[model samples]
Target chain A: MAENKIEIRNLYKAFGKKKVLNGVDLDVKKGESLVVIGGSGTGKSVLIKCIQGLLIPDSGSIKIDGVETVETSENIHEKMGMLFQGAALFDSLSVWENVAFVPLGKGKMSKKDAKTEAIRVLRQVGLAPDVADLSPAELSGGMQKRVGLARAIITKPEIIFFDEPTTGLDPIMADVINDLIIESARGLGATTLTITHDMASARKIADRIAMLYHGKIIWIGTVKEMENSDNPYLQQFITGNAQGPIQVEV
Target chain B: MLKKTLGTFLQTLGKAPLAFIINLGYFTQFVAKSVYNCFMPPFYFRLFGMQFLNIGFYSLPVVGLTTLFAGMVIAIQTYSGISEYGAESVVASVVLISVTRELAPVLSALMVAGRIGAAMAAEIGTMRVTEQIDALITLSANPFRYLIAPRIWAAIIVMPLLVLFGDIIGIFGGYLVGVYKLDFNPANYITNTMDFMKSTDIIMGMVKAGVFGFIISVMGCYHGYRSKGGAQGVGEATTNAVVTASILILIANYLITELFFAR
Candidate 1:
C-alpha cells in the first residue's frame, strides 16, 4: 500500500455491554479515499469516533503515519479534520470564525488576516465571501454542509473525515456535495475516510469501499470490485434487496 | 402481576455503582484542572465581566428581596421571643448579627444557587450536548480556562459583594419593622444596631459567602460539564445542580456556625 498513512488493527469498541467495532482492521494509503459503508447502527460512526479520539476504543491499535494514537488522539488529531453528520457548527460564532477556527489558534495570523483567509477557504468550497459574515444557522442544509466542508479543509490537514456527508441532501445537492468532496480531497492531497450508505456517493467519491455489517467490516474493495463482487453481504447491501439473507424490520 | 414485578426488579438490578464512580472521577478531574488553570496564564477579564453580569448583577434583585423578607421575619420573631424576657431592646442587635453573620450569606447563596447555579448548569449542559465544548477544545482554547474559570472567578468575586448588598437591605428591612411596625424608639434601634455589630461578623459572612460561591460554581460546572443526552438531560442537570447546591449550603451553614459560635 502507498506507505499506509492511516492503519487500524484489531480495533474494538463497545457501549455498555454491547460490543461494537469487533476487530475492525483497515488502512488508507497516502492521498487515497477510503469510504466505509454500512446500514445504520453498524458502528460506522463509532469507528470514526474512535479514529478521531472522540470515543475511546476498548482494544485496538490506530496508527497515523506509523505512530500509535490510542493514547494521544487529541494530539494526533491536530493534523486531522472532521465534517460531522449534523455539520455541528458553533451557533455562537459567525461563519468566518468557524472556518478560521484553527488558524485563529496558531497566533501566527491576525484577526484581519484570519478573516481574509477564511473568505479564501470559503470561496474554494464555492461559498461567497458575504456568506462568511453570516452564521451557520442562516444557511440551508446543503449550504451548512458546504460550510462544514470548507471548515474541514481550511486547515489543510493530512487527513479529513466526513460523517455521512450526503445524508440529507436532494439528489442534485448530493451530487454537488459529492463533487465538492472529491475536489476538496484531491486539491489538498489529503487522505479521506468517509462513512455513508449513499450508493451514488460511494460510486462518485470512494476509491475503495468497505461495508460494515453486524459491527464488523465485512467487505472492502475498489469501486470496480464493489460492482462485481460475488459476496452475498455486498450484493444484498448494494442492491438493497429484501430477500437475500437480510431481514427487514416491519 | 408476576411479569410486572419481575420487570421492575430487573430494571433496578441493572444500575450498578460504576456509573456514579465514573461521574465522580470526572468531577474530581474537572475540579483539579480548573484549579490548575485558574493559576495559569492567559486570564480573560472580559469574560469575567460578562459572568459578573450574569451571576452577580442579574441575581441581585432576588437576593435583595429574599434577604429583606428574611430580616423582617427575624426582627418580628426576635421581638416576640425576647418579649418573654422583657428584652425587646435586644431585637436590633440580634437582627444585625444574625443577618450579617449567618442569614444574609447563607440565604443569599441558596437564592443565587437556585437562580444562577441552575441556569449555568442548563446553559453549559446544553453546550456539552451540542458539541460547543468540543468545538472550543478543538480550537486550542482550554475549556476550563475559557468556560469554567470565568464563572468560578466571577462567583468568588461577586458573591461577597452580593452578601454585603443583601446585608444592608436586610438590615433596612429590619429597620422598617422595628421603627414603624413595633414603635421601638428609632434612635435606640439605630444605636442598638451600631453598638452591637462587630467587624468580625461582617468579615466572617463575607468569607463564608466566598466559600459558598466556590461550591456553587464547582457543583454547577461539574454537573453541566459532564452532561449527556439531549434537551432532557440538560434540564435534569439544572435541577440536580440546584437541589444539591441548596442542600450543601444548608449543611455548610451549620458547620460554619458551629465553627464560629460554638465556643
Candidate 2:
C-alpha cells in the first residue's frame, strides 16, 4: 500500500475561450491527507474535478490506483466520495436519504436497514438520529455540512475529496467540521485531498500542504516548513498580505 | 476602412449560424442519449410510477375542464353558423369530429406543456445549479437513467390516455350544450355523434398527444439539464422550456394534421 493513490500528468482544461486549468500535475500517496491551499479561482477545484472525471482534461493523464482514468469510458466512481462546498444535498430528499444515497439507490440495502445505516453514519458525523427524517432544507449550514460529510463517508470510499469544507461557518463550527473531517478520513483510512484557502484548517488537517497559484502548484511542505519557507507567493498567501507577489484583481 | 468593416460584418454574419448549429448538435445528442437510456436495462419502475401519477393523474381536472368548455363553445358556434344554411342537424357531427381530431389532443397538450414542462424544468434546473446532479454522478448514479428517462417515458405513456379521456368529456360537453341549450332531441344528437365518430380520428389524436408529450419532456429536461450559473439561469430555463414546448406542439400539430388529412 506504499503506492501513489492518485497521479496526474500535465492536465489542461479550458471552457469556450477561457482557460480554467492551464497545466497541472499532482499526486497523492495512499492514506495521505494532502491539503491544497490557493486563492479563489486559481483552478484548485478544476484540478480536483479533473481527477474525479467530472471534467475531462484537454491533454493529460489521470491514474487512480495505477489505472489510467482519463479518456476512458469506464465507471470508476465507486472508489471515490466528495464533500462539495455548499454541501449540495438533494433538497427533495430527507437527511437519511441523502446520507444513504448510494446503498439505497443501488438496492444494496433494504429500506429499513438503509435508514438504520444512515442514522449510524449520521451519528458518526455528530448528527442525532432524529435528524434523519427531516429534509435537507430544514438543516442549518453546519448541520448540512455534517450530513454531506456523512454521505461522503457512508460509502467508505478509498479516496475522499473535500472542496472548501470550512468556508461558510463560524470559527467554532469550522473547527468542529475540520476535526470531524480528520476523524472520519482517519477512521476510513482513506487518501484525502482537500482544497481550501483556510490556513488554520489547513494546518490542523494536512500532513503535507501544497499551495496552488495561477493553475500550478508553487510550494509544498509540512506546516513547520511552510512557516519557515521564503517563497514570496507562499509567504504572502500565508500572511494574508495585500502587498505581495500575488495580486488580487479587485 | 471599408475592407475592415466588410470583414467584421462577414465574421458577425458567419458566427450566428455556427453557434446555432453547435447548439443544435448538442441538443440532438442530449435527445439521443436520453432516448437510448429510456430503453436500457436497470429501469427505474418506481420513479416512472411517481412521474405517471404527477404528469398524468394530477393533470386530469385541468384537461377535463378545458376540453369540456371547448366542446360547448364549438357546439354553440356551429349551430349559429349552420342554422343559417338550414343545416341545424349537422352540429352534432361537426362537434364530434372537431373535438376528437383537433381540440382535445392539442388543447390538453398545451395545458400540460404549461404545467408539467415548466415544473420539470424548474425542478431539474435547481438540481443542476445546486450541484445535486453532480453529486448523483459522483455517487455512481447516471442522471439520464435516474432523472431524464423516467420523466420522458411517463409523459409518452400517459399522454394518450389523458387525450382519450378528454375526447369523451369534450363529446359529452357538446351533447350537453346541444340538448339543453339548442333544444335538440337527445336521441338524435347521440345518433348523429355516433354516425360521425371514426376510429382514425381518435387514433390520430392519440398519436398527436404522444408526440406532444415527447416534445414537452425533451424541451424541459434539455433546458434544465444544461442550466448553469444560478437562480437567474434556472428562471431562464423554465421560461424557455414552456415557450419552446408550446411552439413545438403547435408545429407538430400542423404536421400531423397534414400527414393524415391533407389531400
| Candidate number with greatest DockQ | 2
Tell how far residue B12 is off in model 2, in angstroms.
2.5
Interface RMSD of each: 2.2, 0.7
The docking category that best describes candidate 2 is high
Give the C-alpha lDDT of model 1: 0.87
TM-score of model number 1: 0.90
Summarize candidate 1's per-residue lDDT along A124-173 as a digit string, tens digits.
88899999999888999999999888888887878999999999999999
- In candidate 1, stretches whose alpha carbon ends up further than 4 angstroms from where it belongs are A71-74, A247-250, B1-22, B41-44, B84-89, B185-187
RMSD of each: 3.2, 1.5
lDDT of 1 at B85: 56
